[model samples]
Target chain A: MARPMGSVRLKKTNPATLAVGVALCIFIIYFLIGPSTSDFSASRKATAAAHHLSPPTSPFRKPTGDKQKPPPVAHYNLNNVTTTPNPLENRENILLLTPMARFYQEYWDNILRLEYPHELITLGFILPRTKEGNDATRELQKRIALTQNQGPEKDRFKSIIILREDIDPPLTSQDEKERHKMENQKARRAAMAKARNSLLYSTLGPATSWILWLDADVVETPPTIIQDLASHDQAITVPNCFQRYWNEEKNEMDERPYDFNNWQDSPTALDLAKKMDPDDILLEGYAEMATFRTLMAYMSRENGRLHEEMPLDGVGGAALLVKADVHRDGAMFPPFAFYNLIETEGFAKMSKRLGWQPVGLPNYKVYHYNE
Target chain B: MARPMGSVRLKKTNPATLAVGVALCIFIIYFLIGPSTSDFSASRKATAAAHHLSPPTSPFRKPTGDKQKPPPVAHYNLNNVTTTPNPLENRENILLLTPMARFYQEYWDNILRLEYPHELITLGFILPRTKEGNDATRELQKRIALTQNQGPEKDRFKSIIILREDIDPPLTSQDEKERHKMENQKARRAAMAKARNSLLYSTLGPATSWILWLDADVVETPPTIIQDLASHDQAITVPNCFQRYWNEEKNEMDERPYDFNNWQDSPTALDLAKKMDPDDILLEGYAEMATFRTLMAYMSRENGRLHEEMPLDGVGGAALLVKADVHRDGAMFPPFAFYNLIETEGFAKMSKRLGWQPVGLPNYKVYHYNE
Candidate 1:
């Protein structure tokens, strides 16, 4: 009786023929699969190199992958991200990030008036999925379409990405009075921090050299604001945010401090932070939660000293610019209380912890819309 | 000496064992390769379905692929592409296309002032590679980023796409006198036809129900222009284009007819077309090449009739709205002369050949930029 191929006796089989068959099969499998496996591994490594350099505190870091290891040093050295004397010749890309809840035409006009080369600017916007957020998004999109589709090529932005993601419960009202209520500060600021981080991570491409966190309500920035801010060339720089409001008693428009978050931490503020609950957040510009810190807003003079810079313990989102390496080093807005601070304030603490100095321009002012 | 495995005769081999070995080898090969081939074929069919329904006249059609066969029937039936009475509630997407060489702030302002639900509008632009074109693109991009980043969500556009591709030789001067020269007419119009076609093909998504061919120079369209033109619900509709100019002689602003391309094809015009060379193009509003056709521009009265529709043989591009299926069915602007007409007029001729009627709103005015 004939035996099956698998059951053939080793003594009866020709060892030389069996060896040749096995070698041919192995060669064919390698020929068919080697290139594909190599390509797959290469792409996996590239992805890890791009996104896996997360800090210990990053919520985005993978739980199962290298969590105990320290983050790798950033590819972009902080020393190399200095400001250029002439930005017109500089080709480095700047990412303009905005967290929007309301749309204002005046704010859009100010952005359009910036004299920086639009081709080097990439815009990223994150808006909540609420009714007001949807309304703002629609208006913003219409304006974008008009400018992008009709403008000169050199003045066009490199790219614009809008993300609609809600990180907080929908607010019943966007009224300033309702928004400023002391009880809503922690939740509101934490939601905003999440939005900012979301925009940063999703839009921070490899080409980004700087990040400009300009609030959507910042309506009256100088046309040379980008050049002015970039010329400082600091690790992190923030301009004083002010608003022109009608002083009814004076019967004239008067400028007032807008963002109180740009401040120098005082001994009293540190003591208050220590006494607060672990989950409690510290907020600026409120009488009930007075930190009594020296504010950049209060340091403004009549004529505005353009080159004046001061080291800050906390920063404001309004017209703040930072080198990309600072972010790549794993500094982001904290959505939860970190040392009794959250959001933009927490971001300053995190940046300092990562060895980046946050500086404030006391007299370089960007105006917020007075509504 | 032992014989090799291949040299073993059929009588010496076990037929059942050989059959089992052959079947196992075939199954392994199929297991490794079957899914990939099926996926590849599916994607290829999808691509062919999306792009292969081109007419015989399309210059974009592949020369070697099924040239003799008629184009497949369009998936979007023209009869079903009618405009809704209420666009506010309509979910249909409208693509706004423009061919730009310059950017004007007033033109951008007019687009922003439009009262349509911005979320339903997608803007598309094509520009030349010339210096002026670059300048226009830059300025336009600045405006787009501002609006898109700051506007209310409900008022924003669905999307915006800008394509920078030059089809014509760069013009040394953009002066009206230099541009209007009869010698430059054919090349200029042919290049424009190519730009228009490029923008249309690149931006026409499957969801686009309507296409509004708005010129970048048309600076005074009504806020409800989209709703107004869409209410007509025709396959193709064009509003009369007029320019408001300072009448030094009359000492006031006077409205003058701008687009002369919207006209009824007279017998004299057909005779003129027959005598012209195959590559020659027919231009409107010039006394030198008068075709003696009745123009839609001349049909306007002192008070201006808003709802008056006039059937026409040729159409102007300024504020022209068309159903998307008319374009999908192969009606594109001809870069070459078709009936001695090129660009917008050739598009009208092509539309008629494809059985879509071209209609002009005699007094529904869309003002062109005076400059």
Candidate 2:
């Protein structure tokens, strides 16, 4: 009778304990699985915010937190994604990054004319905190809002971000002669490098498959510029940047080579770099700082050979395309001299250092604004 | 007999279920509390690395991860910290930030002469990737390693960081004439702004209470320079920067104003800024780009009036002291034109915009190296 009574008491408490255990297990599982799924979505949204758009507040706000750690190095598992011959069908996302000091209406118009799927292209711009930059920012925001909110879905960019540069540009003069002075090249390029890095680091996201560095002054290109560049599938590719001007004598638009940065280093150039002061930057297209290198702009012929590609030792920022992995693998415009080069040329050196080839399309022309 | 057997079965299962429950509870609690504590420590270490040292691997490597999020905004709970009149007894941590394109042994020696508590000082340097910068970096590292690892404990700084600028400088010439050229001022200042920002952003940590922007060429100051500057507890402060040159005519050392950037904006300057082109930058010390402002460097007297503070509209980078909160509040050297100004002057403008008063000690002198 005592044993039975003890067992009966045990039986009474067993149901309550079992019920609590079942409830606890369900709660634990829900918490374990639930947050991860939510976290995935939350992170996706954050990536979009980081790379594509800025909140309405201030774009220049420093990311906060005393315990904030540097982000983990990014790795893209491209093994799983099948590569198709046609980039259009591959559905790769391209981030178009531009560092704009002055606004050009023609540049914005040219961007709208690109044949790439607007839904797949994310646009990013880093502007100076100048009156000109302010005006440009306002105009750009207005245009983006109108197109993104009011225009047809097909015409809209997937996302857009406008960042006001945190640092002031040393020289704000847009005068072409002042800009092209060999004396000012080092400073100009260094500032440009900072702008590019700021834009790239701030906006490059996990979804970005490729990065397109388009200058604000690049006003003309083939409507299929994106497809043409992406189809090459190279680590880095740049089209010859040229400018068309009304010739007073001919009365017709005359084409001239503009971006001299795209070039293959001659022995003379390499020798120059070797002998030059580590701080002395070797600039292209200057008589004073001569590096007898072949220019891609001059390589173009009258007839179309748009697909003609040549291996390049250096590249210009104007209308350049790069794979996201190359950047992830550590290639950026050096604000400081790299191998006696800075900015785009420095980036080329950095890319080569990382075992990535930089190639140029000699006959593939992109027209720069006639300053 | 049936009921007794059922009771006996319940008794046998009771211990097993209870044991399982106990084990599950223990596992859950361990996971819940364990990771958070470890995360705290790991994050602390990450902060140290991010702010004080770069790993042996490339410092330029981009922080990885597709799910990377910008750090949360840092909030310093200073309400609990008591404010003492004497900065020496305040136990405040000061971060000395310097942007160097060239290394001067005198500057390093002067830093060592500072009377601030070595254990509370964290030093940071950002050098360009130029040959000059390389030499400077190597020498700086050698000096730092010797002092940090081999020197007496009291002589050792709390921590030190050395960073190579990511972008190439636009101008690398150390020639005083070339550097001070009015045409190159914008570009030079812009590049300097970028370097300063890069160093500030990369090395600033939660532990920092104040920031001292000491230029590499500023080779002389009072031994208690840090204490004198920090004691003011102003949002922003700058000492008069002057230079001593061999006076061939006087047969003695002659003093002259070095940093014209430290000034009180005159009505003429403000009017000029208002009338100037949006992108046009107003530079100091240049006759061509003249703004008739009252310079702090010219206000210093022969005798000891070292604590005379005056309101200022602009401040130079040579030897500026600022509360960390002023920086954390978003006052940075604008690389772009801010009210027709850039770099250090632009920083003063930005600080004012953020509601922080910028003050100058006209009688407080810090000697700049004569170029």
Candidate 3:
């Protein structure tokens, strides 16, 4: 039998070629599952929960049988009342929490313009996971350094905390544009809920007396906003939000779209809430509702003249302030629908479940940036 | 001639192998000189300079002859004389600059303990390029976030800034330890001068009235240190630096290793300066000196009892405050020897050359941390 010399040579080369092929496979595998990969497994959630500052039992623990009593309607003032300024000795320590994705310079400029004492205002920023967000955060950091280094203006921020990480976006296909928009609404809300909860859980300290949740897009607010909110001394309080849009037809400054999240319980809303499945969500602008049940924006011109105090069943995150004790007692932003509501509305519901009333200021309005 | 079939096959394989080898070389080259490489070239320097807030100019500009008149001997009080507090309208903004390689928590804690109003103070930190330094800086950032989120004590900082980058180490060889030590000392001083100048160039703004250089290792200082220094109204002022060493034999706290940089132009020092080449550097603690010629530690008991003001030819970064106008007028920390001194001492020379006297608080001391 003739020796198969070519076969012998091929066999010798096989191991070397096989090794190269194996390395290529390994490289591809690593690239597929690297640090950039997103993981939302139960183990990861447990890990996140374990890192919380407070001992985690159940984030939404009911206040036992004694607390089953219905919460009384809350009333808060929106008029430009001369808020009794507390003496320096008894100044409340306010931790301002802002979940932001953009507008670094304007936010800092507004913060610099705040009339409150820097010694008492702790600024905390939670940045989302996006190139835009990261860039904005870096810009803010440089500004902070610049102001601290050479700005003649006093750097009056009591303390500053900035946390940045990626927040997952809603899953959508390019082909289904309409579905994408609808799904994105819920997805963005869910992502925001996660961001807010993570920030509050990780950063909230025992020394904080109040927590102020301010949206990044709200550009103009009175310097005394913090003081005014704190003076109410309520479980939860939110100011009316109005957008500042250029009146295209009139060629002058005009109020634009307003936030309608601040609302009182209406029969139509209650009926809509009842019709939805327990796991289904009820969105504000998407839900079918009568004109009377739909909560409309509080116009700027009508501010400081309406009812000083009003009951609010649901409130938006534009400018909400809550006593630290309310959160410490176990209230959180429920990401999923707890009672046909989700996100901030769910948070309001959770707060009331613990016997804390939710109050809204109809007349006191903060200006939102035109989108 | 008979065709060599095996040789023909070998030739074809060789070309393929050569092509693979060339491809490997190109890949390795790209990886080796990629974006992650640390470069200290003129281009990189230009890039760094470009990032500066102010227009780039020679950092070490000499004052013209008309400004050569020796500044009038400055007199400042260090005694706790009932200082007249400036009214809110007249309050001068102070920028506290601390270039640190370590000690994040202590620096912030000490900063929080400062008695100055947060509205008037701006905190700036420059961290060196080292693994330890970077880690400490990250820890400080986390602590800042934590304190603002959770700390019960009021956040008292007006504004905070942190800068991070690698500074080149002094050139040295392992063969010569003694020479390495000497060269390293000069190198470190030069490096510190560069860092200080860069920070000042990037952060200094028109609003700043004063720049305070405080070392991170200073663990204890009078709460009213800023007020006391600002009250002097000198072009440049430094506090006496005394290290609290564990007195092993005495079993009590004792000041050992005092900062000798703060000094008068003694005949011995002036004579030494004259002998050295203009390019050579003069170091503290190395030159021969008598007890009186060397300015030693100002004992706590001796504080507020010595000459309220003493002429200082040089000062340490431990605690030096300079009027903003001096920096605005082009005074800088010269990295090279000027009058046979460099860094902080060179800075003193630069300031003096511009008709600004350097003042020393012989009776006021700030405690250095026990290393």
Candidate 4:
């Protein structure tokens, strides 16, 4: 009887179960080697509190009751020297830029929750010329319709503009040695830079005072993020990006550094950066010690001891805010290495060369999608 | 000395005083002959009551407390049979159309005061390709910007579209004989019809359920006007046109009939309508008895007794409500006579031929600007 039953069912392996087993294995492997999770401890918290001595309230804050106290004065160093009073209540015309891959419902939901006024914000997007992009746009339109029905009196965005670009050229060879081929990387970066420049020049009107580069993959951020960045009053600023990863063993989620490109330049690193051929890209993680720079994500020692305003040699596009005037003043995302960097990082270098200070917030972190 | 000075001044014949005297004489003559003011009397009031029967609360009313009673039911005659119903609560998509001539601050203020949900309405404009139209658009933009800044959270219109069309070809000749010239009238009517049709077709989306044609010069109306019209549930309906005029004798404002196009057809009128050549024009006021029809504006008999709902052979476009589906089903403003009528009158005939009922509210009035 047992033999007959086994022959009827167990004799052949179930394909679905086999596939699940393979998937589980791949998932585990990916987490094990992909990135290091941020370690948390009591001492780190104390240090973080000590390092970030004062955090300014956003300027967009609506006045509360008379009992509400005034915000503490914030001091920001320019050129790592001269201190200036922060412009706390400045009303700026902000232009938001996003290069979308696929539409996510949560992305819009998060945007609607932003603490800033919708009337002052102009949203701009660039979608890839792919079926996915078209589907995303359709989904977004339905979302807008739903929003319209729910609140007939809600204010709409000041303006909305959508653009499309073709996919970047693919690499010709898969060989590991040829994978880092300069031509392929340059082609990909160039396409990205071109797409970004087109969006900026076409949509940034005279009224716009600031330009925010937000990647679609960045799914979660505090609603006060925009106001917080504006409060810093820097020429350029970026927030640290963290990716949330599930710790299967711990039965909880953990955070890992997603973008470690924002860093402070050292003499050796500056030399190495300068030595690179104009066309050569200085890879982030690979050229770490050779470039004599330490990433902001790694530099915060003793828990929260990271400096409040760290000089950034390069900026991550996942979330970067810049003065619109800087862009109008000739700063652009260089596809080929200018100062041994390209794309967003290259843009930061270009801005610096124009005598604009770029700052990074080591303690302020925005989450990126795991994918 | 005073007498001598006065004589010298009077002899000089001041040019400004002469011009003022001439303008006053012209104004007096125009007022005396232009249009007759509606006469008032107790008998007329009784007759108006009898003709109207009942009036209902407008749908545009915002709810108050339990003590606030429902609006009185309105009495309407369909095929000459009386019926009463309260149509105070119905929600549907409405497209507001206006052919603007010049910018008026009061006009925008009145629109903003409309009781309907802004998100449910699409505001569309067709401006003449002239300096006045351009100036109006610029002023409108500034007004919108001001409104946005004052109330950032207010619900904005679902969408706004402003289009420009070359002013219908100016009349070729101003000769009084040529002014009523058939070709000139046809050309002017055709131009207006084309402008209206272009605005309607280009902007009306599938989601739109109704079209409200309101002339920009017709400045003021009850906030609940949209709801009032929708409540009728007729294929086509119009509000009585009242021009607000300053009464020099009374030193107060008075109202008079501005549109008398809505009429009941008589055999003689039908015969007259049939006899007209296709190319011949039916001048609004001039075609009176030739068409054997009684204008509803005059048929009201007494001051207030304008029938609430009247059977009409034609209607005016000052303020017209039409079903979107009717337009989709092929009703249009024919520049040429289809039933010995052109422009809005022709539109009524076209809709009737398509098995739709056209009705008018003679008692309900909306005001027009003096200009």
**Leading candidate by TM-score:** 2
What candidate 4 gets wrong by more than 4 Å, as runs, is A1-371, B1-90, B148-155, B167-183, B249-251, B287-292, B301-307
lDDT for each of the candidates? 0.59, 0.60, 0.51, 0.52
Q: How many residue pairs in model 4 have overlapping backbones? A: 7
Deviation from native of the Cα of residue B339 in model 3, angstroms: 80
TM-score of each: 0.41, 0.44, 0.39, 0.39
In the range A263-333, model 1's lDDT, one tens digit per residue, is 89988789998898867887766655567788887888888678889999999788898876566434667
Candidate 3, B81-125: lDDT as tens digits: 111234123555566877666664565677777776544555555
TM-score of chain A of each: 0.76, 0.78, 0.71, 0.69
- On DockQ, the candidate that comes out on top is 2
Over 4 Å off, model 1: A1-371, B1-85, B167-169
Better of 1 and 2 by TM-score: 2
lDDT at residue A49 of model 4 (Cα atoms): 9
DockQ of each: 0.01, 0.02, 0.01, 0.01
Worst 10 residues of 2 chain B by lDDT: B24-33
Which lDDT tens digits does candidate 2 get at residues A1-371?
A: 01122222222211100100000000000000000111221121212212111111110111255563322111112222222235678676677988776677888888888888876677777666556666776777666656654554455665555545444222444454544556766766666675666566545543356789998878898989888987887889899988788988999989877777788998989999889876788877665555778777678888967798999999988889887656643466766566788878988986785568999999999987765
lDDT per residue for candidate 2 within B1-371, as digits (tens), equals 01122222222211100100000000000000000112221131212211111111110111255563322111111222222335678666677988776677888888887888775676767665556666777788676656654554445665555545444222434444444556666666655665566456545533356788888878899989878887787889899887778989999998766676788998988898889875678877655545678877677878857798999999888899887655544456766576788878988986785567999999888887765
For model 4, residues B19-50, the per-residue Cα lDDT tens digits are 00000000000000000011111011211111
Using TM-score as the measure, name the better of candidate 1 and candidate 3: 1
Candidate 1, residue B264: Cα displacement in angstroms equals 0.8
Backbone clashes per model, in order?
A: 38, 31, 6, 7
Question: In candidate 4, what are the lDDT values of residues A1-371, reduced to their tens digit?
Answer: 01121121122111111100000000000000000111111011211100010111111122245553322212221111111122224445567887665677767877777666554555666655456655765676566545432332232443344544434332232443343333544555545665566456435432345777877767788887777786787888888877678978899998766665687776866777667664577655442234546676654444663337788888878788886645643456654455677777878876775557889988778777664
Which residue pairs show backbone clashes in model 4?
Answer: A44-A303, A48-A304, A153-B155, A269-A291, B48-B305, B269-B291, B269-B292
